[model samples]
Target chain A: MRRAGVVALNTFREAVRDRVLYNLVFFALLMMAAAVAVGQISIGIEQTVIVSLGLSAISLIGLLISVFIGVALVSKEMDKRTLHALLANPVRRWEFLLGKFAGLVLTLAVNTAAMALGLLLVMIYVKHSLERSDAVVLVAVYFILLKLALIVALALLFSCFTTPLLAILFTVGFYIVGLYVQELRNLPVEVMSPAMTAFTKGLSYLLPNFENFNVMAMAAHGRAVPGALILQNTVYTVVYCTIVLTAAAAVFSRRNLK
Target chain B: MPGLAIEIENLTKEYPFGFLHLKKKTSLEGLNMQVETGEVFGFIGPNGAGKSTTIKLLMRLIFPTAGSARILGKPISDVEMHRDIGYLPEQPYFYDYLTAAELLDYFARFHDLTAADRKERVERMLKKVGLETARKIQLRKYSKGMLQRVGLAQAILHDPKIVILDEPMSGLDPVGRREVRDIILELKREGKTVMFSTHILSDAEMLCDRVGVIVGGKLRGVGAPGTLVDMKTQGMEILFELRGTSNAPLLSKATRTGDCYRLQVAEEELYAAIDQLRAAGARILSVAQVKATLEEFFTNLVEADGTHTSAVEVSGK
Candidate 1:
């Protein structure tokens, strides 16, 4: 675990030096301010539009960083041939994989925090005074970060043996499936057979239910997010991340890093 | 652990190529050898001759298909044993964003060194590699030789007992190569074992206490460089300088090379040629034995049976 932290530190340093992360964070902030301008076009629902745009921008940019950086986490090292030097050390394959996972998670955490702060500033600029209920936006941003963490782990799992391009494709595909998988479990009788419903229910068990993490609608509309919902989503994200990361480590351990 | 620094027993590695893993290409085939403790061992082979593959296996970057290797008396799979050795891969790549100090410090942490120890060691390694001036500069801005120095610095940062270098001299000038040779010798003086691979036999002949020739994924020979090259000596060459030349049959093939007449005296005719040199009042400038070098042996070994890979990319690495 300590060795994993070393890899994590190095990964963070490399990502910080990269211009892409900064560029994405800058764009997220830009969109937050742009949200204010776009919100003025809608008079009565200005707050809704502003919050919606800010939260959506955070989710979009955060996942883009997560998916892209996560897929290249190992592949970039392999291409640079740095993995050879690392594996030769006291570090194991699993530790290295976990370290990369930890590092990217940390990066996403910092970037998300920055984007969230930006969203807050934009909110203050539009509203005359700070509202106590504005804290609801934090809840939504927290879910976005949790969702990005799971997406990062999924990207890592796909990256164990596949190319970065293919890993990105597969990770995106899984994200799309995860978002709508719960819908399959609750299909209407007229639109679905009993057997198909059973199959979709099984799939819901097998795949992550991303819908559980989407508090964006409630948060953006300035409605309170239930504490029960936050706790449930946190537990789900933890379980899903553990399973995905473990599977990634297993695949990486068996990999022949040619 | 006590007798040898490394031991390999019939190690083999093969990679599957075609769909369904139908076709397999052998990278290393039944390699067997041993390296004694505290000796500079040179692993000589052309590109893709399994030198890198063999090093990778010993380093546990990849597993062997059917054999076992022990490093410092521990099985290759023993993670704890990695603390006693260091490795540098061919054309190694490090994080270009890191400075020499930061890179060395990162590697030092893997050895469980403390904060102060890491700081001291990183500083010492930078000075040893002559990169102290550029310690704060990022790796991407360093020249190739500087990068090699950084690589070397990181490899030895933890002060491991054994150092494994795969083409350590790849991107260096002659002066840099001399510095590397000196560093290897210095490591030996410090009682550390060094194993390096290269196609350039001269470097091997100059620095290696013992050399192993790997061709076509198999070790063709392993012994002291002198003995290995001397065992195949075809004849001896005797050179002398004479103001005038009276043709002697033994000197029939003598050619004027600058101010000397070079003659290849047969093994049986060596004494007879010396007798003639004394009789003719010639200055016996030098009596040197002609023998095949590691390069010649390598070439002849590859020319036969067409086993080794093409030599085009060998020198590039």
Candidate 2:
């Protein structure tokens, strides 16, 4: 655990020093500024439009961080030959993978926090006052963090045994499928055949239910998030991340660094 | 076996490439060698001769397709064994964003060193490798030689008992190579066992107490430097200076070796060859033994086909 923490801190320092967060910050600012312009034309729904656009920007950029940085976490180490010296240490392969995951997750947390703060400020500027229900967006951002953590784990898993290009393709494929899993599961039983129903149900269980974390619309329109749903999303993210990380460690342990 | 730093039995690695990876490319083929405690063992081989592959196996950076190895009587696959081993890879790459001091601190943490110990060791090691002045500078700004020094520092920062270096002297100038040689000798003086791989025969000859000649993923010979060099010998040749013009028939077929004439003679013809040289008016300069060198032995091993490698097995202490 100590070794993993050390690795995690080192990785976090590398990301922080690399200034990767600047691009996300710039995009968030652009998103908020653009929301102001778009909200000006839709004067009646200024707070709603600004909050919607700002939250979307924050979530998309968070996903970008999880996918892009997470893929390179292992692949770049191999390409640069840093893994040679690192894996030679007393550190276990699982600890190394977990360290990388923890580090990137911490980074995502910081980035998301920055974006959320930006969203809050933009909302205040548009509405000229804070709404009693405006605090619900924190719940949405919290879920965004959980959702992005799962994406990062998936990216790390694919990158453990395959190329970054292929990992990205696979992760993006799962991402698109994850968003439509609800619709696919709710397909009209009257019109669908038995085989299609079984296939969709099996896939819904096998693939991550990313839609579980999608509270963007509710938070933007200032609706209450149920306590039970928050707990469920938390449990789901933890379970899936653990399974994927274990699989990554297994693949990484058997690989020959030739 | 207790004092052995490294032990291997039938170590092999076959890398799969091509479609579905069904076709196998063997990188190491049944290699067996050992490094006894307190001795510097040089693993000498040409390029693509499985030196790095063997080191990687010992470090457990990669899994072996077959066979097993032990470090300090523990299996190589055991993660706990890594605490005693230090490795410097061929042209090692480190985190360029980290300074020399920061990199050492990072690697030192794996050994469970305290923050205080880490600070002390990182500073001492950087100074030991002559990088104290540039300790604050990030590694990306370092020159190749400086980076090599950083690699050396990180390898030994934990003060491991067994130090394995793949090609420690690869990118350094002569001065840097000498410093590394000195550091290696220091490690030996402190009673730490060292195993390093290099294609530079002269460096191996100067440093290794016993050198292993590997070619085509097999051990061709293993023994003291002079012993392997003495294993192969052509017939002895008598050398004499060419004086005026040689008229004798015995001197007719002599080959000129610069200012001296070299003539191959049987061991029994010692007196008769001298008599011929005197009668032919050739001046006898000196008689010196022409023993083979490690380079010649290594060259022969490299040039030998797959069918000719020796089956000599050198085990642990």
Question: In order, what are the TM-scores of chain A for the candidates?
Answer: 0.93, 0.94
lDDT of each: 0.85, 0.85
Whole-model lDDT, candidate 1? 0.85
Model 2 agreement with the true structure over A42-152: per-residue lDDT tens digits: 867776677677778778888888899999999999889898888778999999999999999999898888888887877777777787798888998999999999999
Which regions of candidate 1 fall more than 4 Å away from where they truly are?
A: A24-32, A35-39, A188-196, B241-248, B273-286, B310-317
Task: Tell me how each candidate scores on DockQ against the true complex.
Answer: 0.83, 0.82
Question: Model 1 in CAPRI terms: which quality?
Answer: high
DockQ of 2: 0.82
Alpha-carbon lDDT of model 2 = 0.85
Q: Give residue B150's lDDT in candidate 1 (0 to 100).
A: 89
